[model samples]
Target: MKACLNRTIAAAGLAALLVSGTLPPASAADPGWHTSSSLIGTSKYGDDFKRYDYVNPNAPKGGTLNTTTAGTFDSFNPYIVQGNPAAGFAGFGGGLLYDTLMEQSVDEGSVSHPLVAEAYKYPDDFSSATYRLDPRAKWHDGKPITVEDVIWSFTVLKANSPLYNKYYANVTEAVATGEREVTFRFDQKGNRELPKIMGDLVVLPKHWWEGTDANGKKRDIGRPTQEPPLGSAAYKISSFKAGTEIVWERVPDYWGAQLPVKIGRENFDKRRFTYFLDDNAAWQAFGKGGFQDFRAESSAKRWATEYNFPAIQAGDVTKSEYPTTSGQPMQAYVMNTRRPLFADPRVRKAITMAFDFETMNRTLFYGSYTRTDSYFEGGELASSGIPQGKELEILEPFRDKLPPELFTQEFKLPVYDTPQAGRENLRAAVQMFKEAGWVNRGGRLANEKTGEQFRIEFLGSDPTDERVATPYIDSLRRLGIDATLRIIDESQYINRTRSFDFDMLALSSFAQSQSPGNEQRDFFSSKAADTPGSRNLAGINNPVVDALVDRVIFATDRDDLIAATHALDRVLLWNYYMVPQWHLGKVRAAYWNKFGIPEKQPGYIGVDIDSWWIDKDKEAALAAKYKGVN
Candidate 1:
């Protein structure tokens, strides 16, 4: 067989070369488990390293699981932005096919287990994490998974993937201490800092990727995606039909199958991800038993009214709200301040006043979503005060800093159901427009100085957005302003917004972290705005806001972090970088009524797939219950 540098090498060679009597006997220098400093001698656990309650510590495993997603992947190279879910699915599949240094838990919190390494050594606060690679570890084809592989993989991934933001940002260097030992140093001043960021990155093999570039010079692994590519995630590309489907077969006798994340999470015997262009089509196919797991992301009304299976009615399949105490940050309509027309605060406020959110909630969402007032939603690290409580105590100090109207409970933007309030807001909007030198002529607002029509484009992603945005645009048209709806593909939508090219785009900013520290920078920092591909669409550059974000990120105590976040929130609210929209409380997903989903899975959704299981008996019963074809 031809030796492929990028793919996993034979494990026999690895075991023979590194672990087969050639290396020195194991000594005290071998990597050993070290507890997180945050927990120290105490048994208390941080949110980062919470234990799962669902899976028995020693649960039996013998089931074939299938999951359906959207997209096709071209390469096993998980480094580049391929603009497809199949790429992610393929990468995950490859993770099982190959092993990185560490692995994340099902909950994606803390305690990375050893894959190639026997143990991980890090300070309590996670300032640095060092790995003593196991001499016995090998790639599927038998090449040793070594220090060179680790360094090469990190350098390549950090340079290519934009999503690799927090992965190795703190790392100062990765140095090989011995033949089977490597130490990762951090730029931060804290213990356990490295572990928090040490989840598996699917390290690539140096032997495969260490080559020359197009100029015939040695390929720079550190030059972010500049070279062809290299990675060590689970599944490698067997074949790819772009825009159609991607196939990735398992690497024969792959390494790292015993890793913690894999032992529990990525245990699918055979994994393949198929893509469909239309979401409804995909859902229907899943309904007909074309796929094992299907995600429903359409209208809630459709889920309640339209989607009906015999198993769901007979109580054979579980159909209940996935329990969630705290709502995740969600979809919102944000106005880009880069546009000259939206630069004026009054004009932006006027545009926001035109939206009839209550009407849309009643008609479209059926009052399922909460009207969001700030970036963070309830129960988040950033959420402070729904007019009272611990959040209120934090908000009290910022009351003087915030606008006076924002202090009152009723000081929120007018609800669309109240026509009188809506009209009142329109009247105020008219005044603001007049102040900005705009004249109302035949119900059309025109700039008095330039005689330019005050028009704005509301950009959205696909037909779903068009449905919700059209009504808002209609409201604006009625208010003597012309707001056109510009619908685009998901890829184009992301590309345009990332480059800060839109006038007013409908967006749903989901917060990935419990703390609002990083999200704030991505959404509001001038540096992020200036940098391409960052999420700061509004180009907001307030020094006060930047300082608050810095303080919030570094603050140890929860209370101090909340205070700093609230201060930042007030500034964001005042700036109106985005006109807040609704928070769709928990993830509104409907799976095929075949499997038995646990009520108390985990606090977070989307990433906790291991908590979801195949109830073989229930699935068999359901198949019998709904015997006939659709």
Candidate 2:
């Protein structure tokens, strides 16, 4: 993220440099690192602020943080698409190995505290951004980081990483403007979030990547490798067995440890991630103390019935459920509109009706989820009732191209709690299918003109998901449509989904932040429909959707952004692009009692694992308590 620590020199403090709220000026268009809140405002934290209030500055640092996850990793590389990468790779842990240009504060959504950059700033128009580096930053091999590494990292990542290529599409140039400064010039202006998004870029070490390995084999960023790559973060890869586990050891003298943003974080001596292909196996391991740390339960049935395990009853494990304010993700069975069978919105709508969320929530999920009704579910931006005011003004031009119901109806999922309710919903679905050239003949659904029987297939990687998909498939069968679940491995699933090769698949898109921006393009824009690895799993290609996504990204203020996002959500729902799933208000977390954490957690994050450190006395007590109990 930086060639060196800017505050590492004689200035020694940010307050001395930004006493009047201005960073060193570079040019009119490209300002050097500066303290800021918005594109045109001051940051929430003053220049003299030491560390985040959410973290315990006096927290002790020692002991390992263990993680349990489902899946197998084939490579240690996180940038490439060649293999599955392991978890616990960044913040809270080192993500436990790489650092970004800026560190976003855990307590606030809109504010950011500088880390490697010392300070960063853009112009009034946000046409370009310039970063002034801290001079003390270094790579794991003891080599000083340089401006060349920043520029090279941007170039290679934009060229090879699909996500970055799309996310930074507007940024047209990246060149070293000075020894410790690099400028990223954008082709388009007025994108308020671009500068903030740029700070999220993960900087890779160009020197180690281009140099030869221990056996004289040159490293390639495009390929996957078992060899742990060099990093300058607080942790480095200590050891790993590919597909099994990866361990990172904390660096005692980490370069940015004393930086204002990192004062009380990364408190673990080591962090270990253990992977299991089976979810049940992973649960078993946690129960037997194979990995003694934390677990977040995803399945409602499992959480309701499986909490009475020995360790929990022994009072060694603590359970917590937090009511979150985070946006609920739009999780659903994405109907691939690129495929011919799903080309008609009517067919997709009919398939959505076949799902009985009420029954599943009651019988299968232990009534743990609430029905999701919007792309921006559980948030202020979610459209409700009918369109009006500024939002309606944004949608008026496309009124002819959208569903008439967008103006008259509130989008709602069908209720199928009773047999009669299910029948009524099915009847409505049948009418829509009839209009789309599908009809029931001799108890089998088929195209009325072509006499072709309808068949639907679900592509999945996790077998445990079958609990939900299989019942939906059975419901689809009752409607005379032949549907089946096709479970594949993680790699195959990723490749197929990326290429739009499957008809239907389960996907949970990332929840939107308070300010929704460019990422919406990758999720629903027409351009991303054809781009492989894009999040537009439904292959959305409507011109209207594209314009709405742009409007959301280019929104000028909070009101404008909310109105545009509401319009976008309304249009997507009325079209029935995918069946909406369910959401939970709280995150269920369980952890061993040997760790000490802050009393107040980050409001947005719910759980701040970074602020936790091992309690030495508790760890010793746990070892003595459970020594032969497993």
Leading candidate by lDDT = 2
Question: Candidate 1, 251: how far from true, in Å?
Answer: 5.6
Instruction: Compute the lDDT of residue 78 as modeled in candidate 1.
Output: 44
Each prediction's TM-score against the native?
A: 0.76, 0.91
User: Mind giving the per-residue lDDT tens digits that candidate 2 earns over 1-630?
Assistant: 000111011111011111101121232244444643432234456567687787899999898888766667777676654566666552111355777766655555545556556666678777778776778887777887778888888888777766667677888988888888878899988776776667666677898899988999999988877788888788888888877888889998789898877888889998888877656677787877747488776778778888788889989988887665655666677888998898888888888888899988898988878888888777687899899999999999999999888888888889997899999999998898999999999889999999999998888766665877888888888889988898776667756776788888753444555566766776788888888767777888899999998887777666788899899999999888888878776667788888898887765556777888999998888888776221
Task: Estimate every model's Cα lDDT from 0 to 1.
Answer: 0.53, 0.73
Worst 10 residues of 1 by lDDT: 13-22
Error of 1 at 223 (Å): 10
Tens-place lDDT digits, model 1, residues 416-522: 66778778877887887888788788888899988778898888654556777788888888767878988775557655765767888655453433333333455
The worst-scoring run of ten residues by lDDT in candidate 2 lies at 1-10
Which regions in candidate 2 have their CA more than 4 angstroms from the true location?
1-33, 36-48, 90-94, 627-630
So what's the TM-score on candidate 1? 0.76
For every candidate, C-alpha RMSD to the true structure in Å: 9.3, 6.9
